[model samples]
Every structure is written in structure tokens, then in C-alpha cells.
Target chain A: MNITSYTARAPQLVQALEALAQRADNQDSASTLFHELSGITVLVAKKFTNDRTADGMHDAFHLTVGCISLGISQAGIADSNEAKLSFLLQHGAEYVFQMGFRHIKELSALPYAAYVSDFDNDAFIQQRNLKAIFLEICNADPVSVWTGDAVYQNELLDRKRNRKIIDCAKWLRKNNSNGLVKDSELDANAAISIAVIFAVSGDGCIVARTGQRELENLIARARETRPDVEVNWNDFLKKIPPEFQPILRERMEELRGTIVKKIFSKTKIKTVLTELQDHYAGSEQDIDYS
Target chain B: MSENINLPAIRQQVTELVLAGSPEHAEDAINETAEKFGDLAVVEVLNTLEPHVASLHLSAFDGGKMSLATLLIPPKAWAESLAYFAATWDEDWIEDEPEVLAESLFAHIHGVVFGTDDEERRAELLNEALATDWGTTAFAVLFSTAAEEIIEIANDIHNLGAHRSGRTTSDHDVIPLVLEIARTNEEAWDRVLFEIFPDWKPGENELHTRSEDDGDDHEDEEEREHEYAIGRTTKELLLRLRKQVPSKSSGPAKTGGRPSLGEDIFS
Candidate 1:
């Protein structure tokens, strides 16, 4: 009926949802629990809209509940892999914050003269702090919260680590043909696939050495934030479409062959033209040239 | 029994009567002359006064063959008087059969009492009568009395019409007078009187008798004063509820970690 009534009711509802979430967390069925929690959050939102209070505390409470509910829902949907779920939770948190900000903007325009004045800024600050805590939890050590044992053994990690180095070396050899590749787009494209390989290797150094501007930037950012963090890059890369791997490998090989041949020829320009002609000639015989 | 007065014929006669008399004594003389036709059916009085009266008129239908004397008075009164006569008097005095008496009573009142030119006003009166909490018996008596009055007026005016030159009076001159009387009484008395007593058209004096009361207007003003307050309270309640509800995200950030990068690259 009024703001006081709504405020009084909100906590009890939130507590119920939290209890359900806790059960879900313990049971490792957060997804089902998250849906139930979302339903409760939606009810709270509907009641908040029905009551139409412009106070910031009221708005913040509803927003915070909605955000956390959404974050948990997203986390529930994510792969069991801690890294991926962390990513999803991060995105969900961002989305919730944006939603809350929009609500704040709308609340500011309420026709009641005292609406904005009655807002509780402290409550909003507390909500912000809670969000920071959530993000910290998401970014924390995956092993600490990870429920399952590591799927990638050291043998696979070593093999992936070696394969990544060889792939990077091959890409570097192809791109540097004629002494320099010069074209940033071509170099970056080659470097990206190579970086994925390094990511799969669990060796951040390969990413560091790729020398592609974007790859370098990623490495720097990752190091600064989480230098010692051991990311199973191969597991991360497994999330990518399987079809992309073959295409990436084929392109890298083709580029490497052309660059190596171009570098060896006495007449760099003439050799490139001859190689291009030969490649096209072979394609024409196999392909319909009409 | 007095001669049966046809309404048109009576109207012609009353016109002549009114034309021959001074306006001051015309109303009284018309009333006196109409009373003389008390032995005639109420329609006779109505028909006789048609010329002198502008708005009111009446008609009648046959009610089989009753003793002609029994049909002369207003049908309602005539029916009661006949019933009294049949109960008290011997069968030899009842020349007409009981069926004939019933038919005569029905015909006299059905055609003469209810019939009038002002159908709208009559309908309004009927609606008012139906809405009132009067008992069925009381309502029936009132309806019969009103009908009888109309028939008597019609006959009286018909009888009085004999004195005038045949010229129809304007209905505007009579309608307001009847309406004024009808407005004052809760029952349909004015309609009944107009139908039975056509010579008497309402004058300025009758219209002046009614007064207006201001109590309803004051109540309306009070309701208007609180209307805004109620509206404001409703909005306030809704506003408070809205504040309690959760808010949604506005839009994706232009630059953010994974999502923005993914969106930009993919989209």
C-alpha cells in the first residue's frame, strides 16, 4: 500500500530467495535454484513498480536483488569450467549495474517534490560495495571454488605448450617473408590464431612473444591483473568452434609456405609473382575457371 | 343519460363557448357547463372541451350494452357505483348483464382515461409511479383515479364546446400549464385532469407555485473539492510501489571487458 509496507516486505522475500539460493549452492543445483530465485525477484520488482516509490533506497534494494538474481542465473547456465562461469557472471553483473543506473535516472524524474530528497545514498553505496565483492569472488582462484578435478593433465598441457611454440614459430617465419610483412591486418590475423594456440598451451609467454599489437595488449592486461594465474588456455580454446581450427591451421600453413619461398628467391618480386601464378594455375585445373 | 359527446364535436362546441364569453369568466363558465354533462361518459366532457382547450383531448370505445346511465360518470367511479348497485340492488334493476358492466368499465377507462396528446409526459409519470414504493393496490387505485380524471376533463370540455365558434386553440398555451401542475404532484394528476377537464389550461399563477432547492448543488460542490485529493493519494501510493520494484539495465556499456569486446568484434 505504501513505501513503508513495501520496504518491510522486501527483506523477508529476499531472505527466502537467499535461503533457496544457499540450498541450491550446497546441492550444486544452482540453475534450478536460480530460476526459483528469479521468480521471487520478479515478484519483488512487480511489487516495487506497483508501489511507485522514488526513494533511492527502495530503488537500490530492488536493483541489487535483481542484479544478484541475474548473476546467479547466468552463473548457473555457464559451463562447469570456473573461468567461463566467471566470465558470464562478470557480464551479468555489468548488465545488472546498467539496469540499476537506468532505474536511478528514471526515479530522479518522479513528480513528487520530495521523492528524490528521500533517497538513501548510503544504501546505493552498500549495493555498489556488494557488487565489487561479487566481482572479486568471480575473479578469485578457480581451484579454490572449483568442484571438479582438473580435466587437463600435465602431459596434455606439455603437448599443447609445445604445439603452441611450433605454431608461433611457423607463423612468424611466414609473416616475415621479404624481410617484413608490414601489413598489420595480415600480421594480426596470423598472430591471433597463434595466440589461441599459446592460450591453449597454458603458457602465457607464447602470447607475450607473438608481437601482434592486440595479442600483446591482451597479454599485458592479463599479466598486470593476474600474473601468476594458471589458465588452462587449451580448455578455454576448446570452447571455440571446432570448425575454426582447421581453417586457422590451413591459412597459417599456406601463408608460411608463400613467405618462406618469397624470402629464398633471388628476385623477391619476380618470385612472388611466379609463386602466385603457379598457385592460381594449380587452382584453375582443379576449380571451374569459367 | 346525457348525449354521448364526440371529442371533435365537443371541441367545436367549446371553441364557440370560449369565443362568446369574456376571458375572465370564460374559465369558470366552461367549468360550470362541463359539470352539467356529469351523466355523460368522461370522453363526452373531453370531446366537448376540445375547442376551448389547446393541449388536452380524449376518446372512448364501446363497452357492450350496459345500462346507459351507468356509463355516464367517470369509468373508475362508474365501475365502482355499478358494482355497488349490482351488489345492493335486485337483478331486475340490473338491466345490463355483469359481463356488459365489466366490458363497459374497461372500454370507458381504457380509451377515454389514459388517452392524451402528451405521450412523453404520460410516460414520465408512469415511470415515476412505477419507481415509487406504493403498494400494488394503492398504485392501481391511483392509476384508475388519474385515468378517470382525464376522461371526465375530456367530456366536460366536450360539453362546454357548444357555446364557442369552432376554432382550435394553440397547444403551447395549454402544455406548460399542465406540465407545471404535473411537476408539482408526484402522481400523474395533471395528465388525468388535462384529459378530463380540458377547459382549464394552466396560467402564470400555477407556474409560480413551484420553488427550487439548492441542497443537491452543495453536495456536488463538496465532491468536486475532494476529487483532486483522492487522485493525488492514488498516485502517491503507486509511486511508492514503483520505488520498491527492481529496475532494469538501460544499455550495454560502450566499452567493457569481455562483452563489449565480443559484441564489437562479433556484431
Candidate 2:
């Protein structure tokens, strides 16, 4: 359809989606709804490419995806049919725009056309890509959207926050001796135990902060984006022999202990230890300080 | 604009400029976007617009020279313009009589009929459009058909990434041929549009968009099924329109004049 039909059809599409969303209370209806929605969304992930480098492909796609996603969220609150139609067109444009992000290698058949040019898109894809980035950062090290300092500062703000969180935050703040902490906090590494606060804080968007789920997601996302990559997080771990389990565990313990230990009093350490007990989901035994 | 910029707000501001008798400013921004990026780039840029932007652009005072934005005005804007024209269509706007215009439209109808590969179905469409209220409305429906035909040609070309699959002069792809006829019919349309027609055969992966693995496994079976179904629906419509074998029972598609502002072709 041309712009004319598309514009006219958009409001009805949105209305249909809204109606389907309401009917989505049932599984069959939900499945049908998902199927229909997928039909429209897959249009966004269509094949196209521009003159950008291969390295720029991933970033550009995400940037466009983020922008498109944000455009959907900040869509005009439609009091009239016209406003509503624009909302649908924005959603369609997001997909059409996304076609510009195909990799050059896959795009050898495509003729070079100048695609959308914009500065970097640091959009708040808080639910998907950004959250994944945040989790992976904290998982690799301890840095997070909420670090130990952030958690501590968070505690100081609340009247009825976690008592254990308060104790841990105070213990963490005691180590602010050598560096200037801007905003009285930083996105530094949070303790594995402390980072768990956001992980299991009932936020479904963050699938996991660290561990098997996080590793699975990392590998899954990696493979989803680039299918040719040979990396497999599960395969690598599974290949490790059962006999070396205890030895690896001992080494792992050593690796886990070099945190703020000097002034990390028994109470603070105990709080971390308690949280750590459930951290591994009973795959390994509870780690002990004794 | 910044990465985290408010697209709606920027569009709102632009829309305000266009509406409050300052369309030149928005036109200037559109021109800048087109020059800096590309013509197709305007599609992404216009995706941010509020409603009624098209109606404002298509107005007599402003004119539809919306730079590259004219190439692909978001459908919402088009819908608004479609409505605007419907509401404001004045019979007195055209001095030519219906019979005289009908006679004039006959050759143009053949040109458009040749545009679509399936000439028989398009001929049937012309016949049906010709049967509309004394050729004035027939003229409207015929132009709509030509517009639709042109759009189909453009979309097919674009989906192929404008490659044309190494088919040079006299390649005789329906796309380029259709574009030629459409460029004649739509003389005032975007010039860039006429330049991007491509030629590729059916079942041939000329664009190489489909990887070998895609044929092997699709992650979401249901989604794949739905997508197939959606595409099948389009093909089904085409097949119905262009009946391969002329049967006694199932004849030419019985679709009548379809320029009823909000009438869904799919429906």
C-alpha cells in the first residue's frame, strides 16, 4: 500500500491491536493476537542495508530500534482519529527505518542508498537492550545502574528500606577514602550479593543479574544477532569435567573474596553470605567463611 | 537531533510551523534532511510527525513540494490528506465534462493496465472503474488504480533494495516498465521514485535477503506461519485479481470503484 492507504489503515490497525489486546485474556486469543502483531512487527526487521561498516551495523540497528521503540512509547495521546493514525504510522516507520541496519556482508546484493543519518541514539530501551547491557556489565564486574554506593544512597533516601541493605550500605560507604564520589554515589561494582537487590526485585524486564540465566541470555542474544558465531556459554561450562568441580569451586571462592574485606565487619559480611546462599539456586553448596 | 531526542515534540514543532503558515521552515528542514542523508531518509524523519501534517502539506497554499518527504509521507499523513480531499472535492474544480474526460482517460487507463503484469485483471478494473457514475468518479477510481499500480511498482523495486539484479537497458522487468508508464501518469510525483525500479525474477534470491538457514529453521514457528499467511493473503488477493485460468464460475475480480476515502481494500 502507498502512504495514502497506509495512513488510513493505521488507525484501524491500532484499534484492531487494542481489541486483540483486550481479547488476549484467553490463551487462544492471545496466540492469535501475537501472530497478528508479529505479522506487522516482522515488517520492521525486513532486509535492507546502507553504506555503513560492518562494525557500525549492530550499533546502528540498536540505535534505530531504540529510537523507534521510544517513538512508540512517547506516541501522541490520541484524542482524535488523526492523532491515532500518526501513532500507527510512527510504529510502521520504525520498522521501515530498521531495514537500514542490515550488515554489509549480507547486503552484497543491495545497491548502496543513503539511509537515515542521525547522531547516536542513546534511547532508554530500559526493558531490553539497555537492561541487558546493564546486567552484563554488573555480571562481568560489579558495575551496575545500581552499584554498592547507589544501593547505599538509595537506602539513605528511604524511611522503611531493608535494614540489612542499610547495614551493607554503611559498610560500603566506610571505604570512600581515596576517590571523589560524584553525586555522593557512582555506578561502581556492587557486591554480587548487593546486585541481587535489583535482580530479584520482582522486575521481570531484568531476567537475571548474574548466573546461568544471564549467561544463557548473553549467548542467546549473541547468537540471535550473529548466527555464525561459534561461542556457546553453556557448551563451554558443560565441557568442564565433574572431577574438577571441587578444585574449580575452591579457586572460585578465592576469586569471590577480594572485596571490601578489611573493614567489612562480620555483620555486613554475614548479610552478603546470607544473600549468597540463594544466589546459586542450590546448584552448588552454600559458601562458608569458616 | 540527539539520540535521546523527543521525536514527537520535534514533529509537533514542525507540524506547528507547517500549520501556522510557516511550512517553508518545515520544508527547509525536510530539504536539509534529504540533502544530508538521502531521499528515503525522509521516511524515517517523517515517522515522527503528528497527524494532519499531510493535509497541511497537500493544501493549495503550501503545495505538496515537501522535498524528499513527498517520496514517502507517513501513511497517517496520507490518510489525513485522503480525507481532506474527500471532504473538499468540488465538482466545479474541474471544467472538463465527464464524457470528454472519460474519452481522454481511455489511453491513460491502457497505460496503467500495461503497468501491472497481469493485464487482464487490470483491464477488468478499468472496465469496472469506467462503469462508475458517468466517468467523473470513474476518472477518480482510475487515477487511484494508477496510483496503486505505481505504488506496487515502487514497493517491489524498493524491497529488492533497488538492485534491478544486473538487468540493464531493455531488461523488460515489469517494474521499470511500470515506472515509465507511472512517471507519465504521475508527472508531478517524486522524480527519485522513477529512478529506483529494479528487475528480479520469482523464486530467485537476487537480493540474497533469505539466508540458507532461514529455509532450515525459523525460531518462532507460529510467527513464521503467520507471516507466511499474511504474505499468502496478499498473493491470494493478487491471484484473485489476476485469475490465471479464465473459468466460467470464477471470472474477473468483482471489485468496483474503491476510492471511498476510508474503504479498506483488504476488507
* Candidate 1: stretches off by over 4 Å: A1-66, A70-180, A184-290, B1-267
Best by TM-score: 2
DockQ, per model, reads: 0.01, 0.02
- What is the interface RMSD, in angstroms, for predicted model 2? 13.1
TM-score of each: 0.15, 0.20
Docking class of 1: incorrect
Query: Across residues B1-267, which tens digit of lDDT does each residue of candidate 2 receive?
Result: 452254444466667778787777877766666666565556565765543454455342222132444445543443333222223222432233433332333333333344345545443433433332222232332232233344444456545533442233433223343444333333322222212112233333121112235555656643444332112112222222222112222222222221121111011
Kindly give the number of clashing pairs for every candidate: 51, 5
RMSD vs true structure, all candidates: 32.1, 26.4
How far off is each candidate at the interface, as Cα RMSD in Å? 12.2, 13.1
Instruction: Name the docking class for model 2.
Output: incorrect
